[model samples]
Target chain A: MMDKIIRDNYQRETKIIDAVYPRTYRDSTIVHSDRLQCVYDVFTYTGDRLNDEGVKMNLMFLHGSGMNRFIWDYYVAHLLDYKLGAAINKIVTLDQVTHGDSSVLNRGKLGVGYDWSDGARDACKVAQKEFYSGLEDNSDDIINIVVGHSMGGFQAMCCGVLLPSLFDFIVTIEPVAYSPNVPNNSNVTVLPPKFFKAIASKVEDEFKNEAEYDKFMHERSFFTKTHPEIFERFKETERINMEDGSIRTKMERRQEMLCYMTLHPTSYWLLDGAKHIKVPVVSLVGGIATWAPKENQQVLQKSIPNYTVDVVPQGDHLMNIEMPDEMLKRLSVHFTKFAKEYQSKNYDNSNKSVARREEIFEEIYKETERNRVKNGKPVLAKL
Target chain B: MMDKIIRDNYQRETKIIDAVYPRTYRDSTIVHSDRLQCVYDVFTYTGDRLNDEGVKMNLMFLHGSGMNRFIWDYYVAHLLDYKLGAAINKIVTLDQVTHGDSSVLNRGKLGVGYDWSDGARDACKVAQKEFYSGLEDNSDDIINIVVGHSMGGFQAMCCGVLLPSLFDFIVTIEPVAYSPNVPNNSNVTVLPPKFFKAIASKVEDEFKNEAEYDKFMHERSFFTKTHPEIFERFKETERINMEDGSIRTKMERRQEMLCYMTLHPTSYWLLDGAKHIKVPVVSLVGGIATWAPKENQQVLQKSIPNYTVDVVPQGDHLMNIEMPDEMLKRLSVHFTKFAKEYQSKNYDNSNKSVARREEIFEEIYKETERNRVKNGKPVLAKL
Candidate 1:
């Protein structure tokens, strides 16, 4: 079932990969007892980074909801096809808290408690520690392109807001944001800070074996867009083998919903956050009538100064996973365009700063009240 | 796990359903079949066809690839929410030949031999024998609606062409057609009475037990949009429990590719066939850059006079299986519009014809040559 196109041949050389960012985010609001650290993978090509005259860019791939960094192995392995066997200088991918290997390392405490907003917060921290810090010496000399789908797209936006100059270009594929037109689910958390139980009460959380889960996922319509190996990769990285010899998703059900609940307020923060993005941003709409309201992008385009929208008509929210080639094609074009423009201007690291770091956290919580007053969306508050 | 909204409370009733159209399309030039018939299920509302005052119509739903008639159970079972326990009067759904009970009945002969074109041929024959003949009495007083996804969409076009007057309206969802932009795989099946064996040498065919296959398919991303019972229903109808204690898909892997190959030439036949559709037709694009070429839909819209397109943003080729609500929403809008317009001018069944039935087979082969001469996609002539 493993697609050779995605994980074999030249790919066979750089197959096994994992990175553990040792710094734990101790202040996680939702999972009070849990200690979570960022886990990521760095994919370096068969040869050294293209230092010579060649079209090169660094990539940070952000995965969507309930997905681990390993899901990105498909793109990392296949992006080599964009060129004969090289394009990116360094590829960095990460697992958000309550997801993938990071949660497994947290032991049993990484429960159904982590929120969506915390994911963005943790993502920013990881990018700062793993990627941005690594670029401390070179700084803005190299172009860093962030390609994200779904929740990763949402977190990419947070990364943009937190460190405006870190990523030179960002591509968002089917990231959900606040849409006034979409009716709020009735289970939105109330002010006393009690957690909302899982809406997914009926979802089967465990399978008898690997083939069972594999066949379960393989038959669905969504994976028809994904290469089989990616799911195989996810199965390896994101599911746990229980004591009963059954496999279950790394994300527990209630905690998964809590991720949605915790990050619920940030949807309102997005339009306002659009003002802070100094870099060129591109939004990819998966389909016209998608889960993310088209109006969210419309509102974004209207609010932001430098923004463009790409419509990959054949894609759904998971198009990044569905059609990586088209997604890569878009990223390559954007990188080339931005590199040329920035190169012409002789852009440098002069404008970079840690000054916004303090203000960024304030912005996430500050906007919550403003949004609540405006009846934007229900905001999450601690107990 | 059943989604409460899709299958609970009201869904407990009407558990038994099955209808087999017995007449074999042995004359089908594409399949040279020993015997073949379409298997389908019919769902009648609580009080029969509410012909007295309901928004009366007869609906036929054709499923996508590797699927059978049982998938429609979700839509039929859940439609009660639209009108507090009632909606459409009669709903009919079918399994394409070489699938479901039809394949089971065909025994071992239903192998890589089944072609996609033959599927349309069989569907046309089923509609002719069961639907058209039944309507000989009620005729114009009733409206016939055909809704299909993926290959079903392609076959729906075939149905529209073969019997233009039989169906009053048709809706196509992410249906496969052809475009020169799409790269033909390395194997462009050349033909001259030779059977090209299965290209799927790598596919894992059988599991040790039904539990293994069941648990495997239960975990894939594609089925996220479908209700669990539909899959369970599919397992019941389409998979065979072998005597040696193993489970194999009723659809062999080779038959799937041959479905793509056998009908390869028909992509060129589509534009010409579109000219024959007199009824109002609507095409739903799954996404911008999907497996089904955007140019295919563009060409269809250009060729067909009475046609419209609705872009379902959140869907890929399997949109029918993913977000059925959105699919149904588009259908409802189309039905409402067509009903109001056709109501203004009384339409009748005088054009119904058996005379053209003989010509349908001749036309299939005739178009094959014209398409080949037009430098159509390489067709599998049968090896």
Candidate 2:
């Protein structure tokens, strides 16, 4: 039913742009994908000057479900100013394939190979195509940053591994990284195959009609109790309507299910990728107490040796939306430090460049190792 | 424009019903009044029958805007259990005229005299009507407490004065009582008429078209960002809709304006009312340093000689929603003490109920007074 709705309502249009800002830009396009055949959209901001001495930053933003790119409005607005001021080099953000104006997938889209990693890969492809294309044309220096929240957090980790060269820094907010040792069959961790089968069979049987399907979606969606005001806004921008008066998501339901279902590798893959990378990484975890557990943080810190995690005290999974100023402040601090390090190399033409980088990397590794030890855990193997 | 959208999309057939429990048989009714032209739901849980041996304690609840009686779901679900079983006698809740499935009033439908005072009066009427109806129907006996939050706090204050007989104890959560003499309105108390006009104009402009209006209502209403999940559920329940391709609010814009535009008389009116009321009153103020000035509390304490005020740390206007456990804990403490006094009076015929009640009330009042004096300013009064 969701798939049919997406097919009926999905619409996409793209226009190339000469410039978004800063770098005498050219070749910009917008893509609209369907989630469950509903129209989902993504706006790509491609760099203009490929050979400029600019630090390329790839920002893959993952918005929570029921919201779109508008959640990043403040950040985007700031980026516009940053670009003009040359404060930032370049940025690329996409509506998650299942969320924003992206396409909705079908329920059949679930399983090991079709999970969040696929979504991250899709996002990486978009960034690689845009940034790599710019690099290919102009040879501009590129530094990648991947950021996501909730499901987006899951994707950010996926992208960290799938496109290791593309992202030097990765930040995830409240990533739902369940431990492999913990029972995945629990309702809170992952829906068991039996539960999925029941839900799928029920949806197939009861939601044959668009209205029934839409009603079912509204009823079962995690955001069922969302404020009417917000739900209405989401409806206006995030969903597409069918000719039969039924509605479906623009992103593929299958993609969304794939994002949730394929978590077998755990976030360990991303942690391993982080070990191989030579860039700084940070994660902002909202300490909601009710949702994100301390165990998850412990696991992430244990696996990822070169990552700094800051827990925002009274924040939820949507920390970026709920506490934008705090999130921005922390991000700015990390970025400024990275920028300084990148610039410092120019003044010191010492052969210690590799050694200095290694030293910083070793410092991060030591801190993470100490943390693991203090928390009564085994030391992670160095990359 | 909002007024028109409400008129177009208002659900006239909506009804409120009480959830009856076996232990406590509370009388509940849904009144469809032409004055508001919507359902006014009232739930009255009579005190547990103690064979006229226990004191009657009545708690009148006033929930915040954009929330129905469901906001007190925790109170009903947890607090009212055995923890508070021996402390209180009865609990009563009413859906204010324009809120919940309560009566939806359009502009000019309620007489020109309508305002916050009128809202209080309407709530009092419901309480009294329920009280009398319960008495006639032999629904448990007791009337002693009044609890409200935000706008409900204001209503609770008004009810305290207008219906003094109904409550022997009161709990107000962040009640905004304006003080005309306070310098500069430092507490941001005097919400300028311009603010309301600006919002009204925005609402009017946004709701020009039915579809557009519905969309606008959904995005701008209080329900938008606060609790998206609940809002979606409401939409699914058909309690709210975006059917016209525009957002139509379940609540009338005029009613919302009435809440913000209207202010309780800040001067001697409240003080004098407080003076006339012999009931013990506890005002729970959220320590929203950004929004609440320190001077307001001093003024409030000075005005109500018998009043006890508590400053909840790191709390906001939505304290009930934000810190329900704390609020419930404080309320339970006070109610327990009151219940003990009543029980003592019954057990020992020589015990003076008035003296005992005054003793506890005086202790709370004196403590609050000292805190206010020490803080060096009347914060609540200033606001």
Candidate 3:
């Protein structure tokens, strides 16, 4: 009955995202433009497709870790049916490589190992082909907007910063930054890495069928608190039949562990990206999320130029899911204004504005450090 | 029959450590040298009491978070029976101020909501009275050594660093440092802070008797892996029957959460202490603990003048519990050597030795940074 309810929601065709990018595993030679296929769903506006205006605006949504493009399917349906009437031309959602129906070229060699940089490069490849390549002489007239959550958020920010000309407008929600300045409420205890390896070991590679998998999932809550329908949609979208005549998850456990261990360390990449990015950013924060909240955004915004924030009041870390209406309401205003100004060629995409914003962020950091001293709080150490 | 089996081991009196120290708490005025009592168990040496050479080496064991001094009781029993063999004079194990039978001076205000710095201060106060003040003016002749695990390990490092005059020798096992430079492999996912609060709220503060609590605990694992007798000893020593009607855990749940939150953020205090500390430090690593291992110790030692490490093979983060014999074996060698040298007045306690050690540490950091750059690994951000 549950599977029927979920399957009924996603009856549309799932398109594969074909792209090739360079990849490297630990202690091995790097592979350049290695073939990769990710899956995505695109939503076109009801009436805006044939709009008389020459300027265009489209959104590309990126999902976080342990989740696929199915996360945005609910938002797309809700947005089209009720929100954003005819404000946008198109909306694109893609599963990250190794997630959902995604596959890589060197199957065995690239098994379950990929870095955040790889994810960023892959997203860039997909965006370049789908959004930019076929553009006519009016390339500057288009705004390839990007929205991402968690891991995707980190990757999206990287895309916006690293390849500035590719992605125009960016919105990153609760991007993970492990810097000391970021207020993380996660467990600080040294739980053994083997504990996760053990958890992975416990997962059986083969299940009799979807029914057995469903029954097993019914006994356990995936996350602490989440809507039942969302989890059901996940199982519907991500679970698949294996070639060995059994049902199993699309992504492997060993790969997930590798992803965590390899990329979990914090150094200076995110901050470096933020330091040089030419565009403005809107960082969304879950109001009550102590783990990764507005405070972390404040740290990012202080360092990054023109990085503003929107907080969903009373929302948890799953802000996009828990408070979709609030998220859309906050985002639509910015989208409408951006589209209107860009359409009229009135928006300034100049270096002067970027310079001014940099000064503003500098001043903010200085003020924060001053007040921290005045209030007897410890001043955050910078790199 | 089960109770008989459990209680058969810990059949000694649990002594209360009485001392007075200044304290401040939430929503209360500062109080000076407030009288407090901490629980402890002292184990004297075998056969050899007074050494022929008139040398002395005393041991004080400090337990980790959510644990009483009963942890060292196992080591003491094992060491006295076999390992130490009268090389040391006395071994005393004390509960941290907010744990075990310790009574806070400001009872209502400090109900388990103290910071790590407070833990350090309280520990110093206990050491001053119990170890130092009890002795005659031969302070330089006698070695006041301390061994601690987890939070206690951190505090022991702090004691060795901050109050270098008091604490002569220190062995810190798996100390927690939340700095960016300190590589930690714990989960970086944002879990709700309320989860711990909710867990605390569910705790039945008042239990009918020891049997009920014992039955309750039987369902849970104390540490990752521990000997049955050690856990059983914890129940006997830390669990107590309250006068009015019920039995309860010595440490409150709220206190545990506060300790985690207030002290979790990274700062310059430990680094500042490390820069100017006078005593030698030995940091023990569970060879397999990726969370905070030798790499992190290298960072700490770079700033500290005299810091070395001992790695326990095939051990987890809980070094004291998992490899008690190895921990003691490594420590006993150092203790015996230090005692003999001190007796002969031949141990190097010169400024030149400290200076030379600092240079060695500086070279290690430089070499590590050079190798990191050479291998294309990101250099860890310095505070």
Indicate the docking level reached by candidate 3: incorrect
Model 2 lDDT tens row, A74-175 = 554344323221244445555643455444332222111233444564565566445444333222234556778776776676654433335656777777
Root-mean-square deviation per candidate: 31.1, 32.3, 27.1
- Root-mean-square deviation of Cα positions for candidate 1 versus the true structure, in angstroms: 31.1
Could you give candidate 1's per-residue lDDT for residues A322-349 as a string of tens digits?
6777877876666666777766754322
- Candidate 3, residue A150: Cα displacement in angstroms equals 0.4
What's the DockQ of model 2? 0.00
The candidate 2 chain A region of ten consecutive residues with least summed lDDT is A23-32
Model 3, A1-383: lDDT tens digits are 43343244333445675533223332111112124666766565444333345566667888876667777766665543333312455567887776666732223323333556557656765665566434454344557788888778887877754355456678887776542321122211122334444544434334788677776556442332445656667777767677766787765543444444334322134454465455678888877875453445756787667687877668776777556666767777666655665566443323233456445434543442232222122221332
List candidate 2 segments past 4 Å from native. Answer: A1-383, B1-39, B42-56, B65-68, B85-90, B103-108, B111-113, B132-141, B179-239, B242-245, B264-268, B289-293, B347-383
Evaluate residue A240 in candidate 1 and report its C-alpha lDDT on the 0 to 100 scale. Answer: 79
TM-score for chain A, prediction 1? 0.73
Candidate 1 lDDT for residue B98: 61
Against the native chain B, each candidate's TM-score is: 0.72, 0.63, 0.71
Interface DockQ of each model:
0.01, 0.00, 0.01
